[model samples]
Target: MPSVEATGAKLYFEESGYGYPIIFIHEFASDMRGWDAQIGHFSRSYRCIAYNARGYPPSDVPEDPQSYGWELAVDDIAALMRHLDIEQAHLIGLSMGGYAALQFGLRYPERVGAIVAGSVGSGCHPAHRDAWLRETSVPSRIFVEHGMVTMAERMARGPARVQLKYKDRQRWREFILRLRQHSPQGMAKTMAHCQAARPSLHDLSHQLSDMAIPVLLAVGDEDTRCLETNLMLKSELPNAGLWICPNTGHAINLEEPAAFNAQVENFLGAVERGSWLRGFPATATIPSLVRSRGARRDHSLIQIDQETEGADVVRLHLR
Candidate 1:
């Protein structure tokens, strides 16, 4: 097994093909294998690297509960890149992985060529932060008490994930099998430390607005937990383009692999050609629900509803 020593643990990673580097980061519920669909397609055209974050097996599972967290996860990405001698690479992450990729760009702006974050924010909303923290902690107990078997049973059918079950039962079953393989201790610590405690994206507006790296913020329209914050990300990130997979939910990359691959491929090509330029700043148009009263710069809502292949897509259009 190919692995890199990072932070206090060894991260197991897989690599293939040869071209501009692209690193795949997995969600909390997944390990490096979650990116198999992407790795197969992208490795043909890019140097695809996928790694298991610390605590995921084949990777060391640190015993200290405090060892796992959002910051540590970002550190693992930086460490992996440095060990691989990659100064910069395109980052593709989903769910918890999405959160890490976004933060990686913020913390290491100079080392990011581009970012494609799917279903990035779920429990980071301002209006429900406390509730999210409480809810996120509940899973830690469930994982420690009832174990991974119970986790796969519930998480696979979560509101944002059920779309995968409905769209492709076989794939969903594969997802469950993978989930079952994860360490219950790892999942518990992740929920308690990383998911429950990472800084809210809404709190990083200025830093997000200043980042010039091309970003593709992809999310499913029915992933209601992430929609508001995705809108916030679009409003703040200068070089971001939002893509909402209509009639879809979370596990988007799995539920709609072809669309996900195509959108990412197109975005990468555009960025390479210098066609994916920054969008106009919209700090003045932050939604009241998304921004603090003290941070408000504008008051009107500017939604641009678009249709591609007949599915309604909502986009921000500040003027």
Candidate 2:
């Protein structure tokens, strides 16, 4: 069991293969084990490192509520890399981890090769800030009152996560089992401070616009909470490319590992080949995709109308 000291806590991590480092950060409901599929696929060609965030088992969980925060999460990633003697690496993070990775890129641009931000931007839109804060406390209180099993069950049934339950019941069961093992106090503090009190991504427009590192913004079509925020990120970040998985949900890496893995591999390939551009081409335009009756419901093909110059129209079919 390899571990690294990160601020006030120690983080447990696992690594495989050897090449350019690729760090994996799990979501709020998951731990490093959530990245098993990704590690299996990427480790063959690249060094894959996944770590359990603070508050998760195998990682130190500070007792004080004040010890958990968004900034600390961002700094923890840096500390882990520094501890491992890694200069720069590609970062892939989901949900909470994604937010940290984005902040890390902003704070340390010179230390990042590329970034994959998946299913992020929850509670980040300005219009939803108030509601998000209020709703976030509900989960925190639940964890404190009913414990991890009760909280895990409720969280597993979230609207954006129901897709996983239906698509793969076995994996969904495993997810719940693992989630139930998390520290209730750690979760409560994380939800209260990190999720409820952290600043929204909308507040970082200036930094996002000036980002120089290549970034891939991925979210499921059914992840309604992140749709608007991800769109905003695509518009703000000059180096970002957006990909919306059809009929997928928040835990996309688990729901559709093949597609997720393929997309990430392609992006990494482009980066390695120096073919990944800084921004969308001047002539490239995203046209509205209006579905025809009887059209395929499982997948969507985006039609880009490149005839118009500087056209940035974005519309998608939503169920």
lDDT of 2 at 222: 99
Each candidate's root-mean-square deviation in Å?
Answer: 7.8, 10.4
Can you give the lDDT of residue 15 in candidate 2? 94
Candidate 2 TM-score to native: 0.87
Candidate 1: tens digits of C-alpha lDDT, residues 178-222:
999999988888888888889999998888988888999999999
Clashes of each: 0, 0
- Per-residue CA lDDT of model 2 for 1-319, tens digit only, reads 7999988899999999899999999999999999999999999999899999889888988998777999999999899899889999999999999999999999999999999999999999888888998898898988989999998998899999989999999999999999999999889988988878778899998889888788899999999999999999998887788999999999999999999999999998998898777533332222233236354545444433332345676434333
Candidate 1's TM-score reads: 0.87
Q: Residue 248 of model 2: what lDDT? A: 95
The C-alpha lDDT values of all candidates are 0.88, 0.89
Model 1 score (lDDT): 0.88
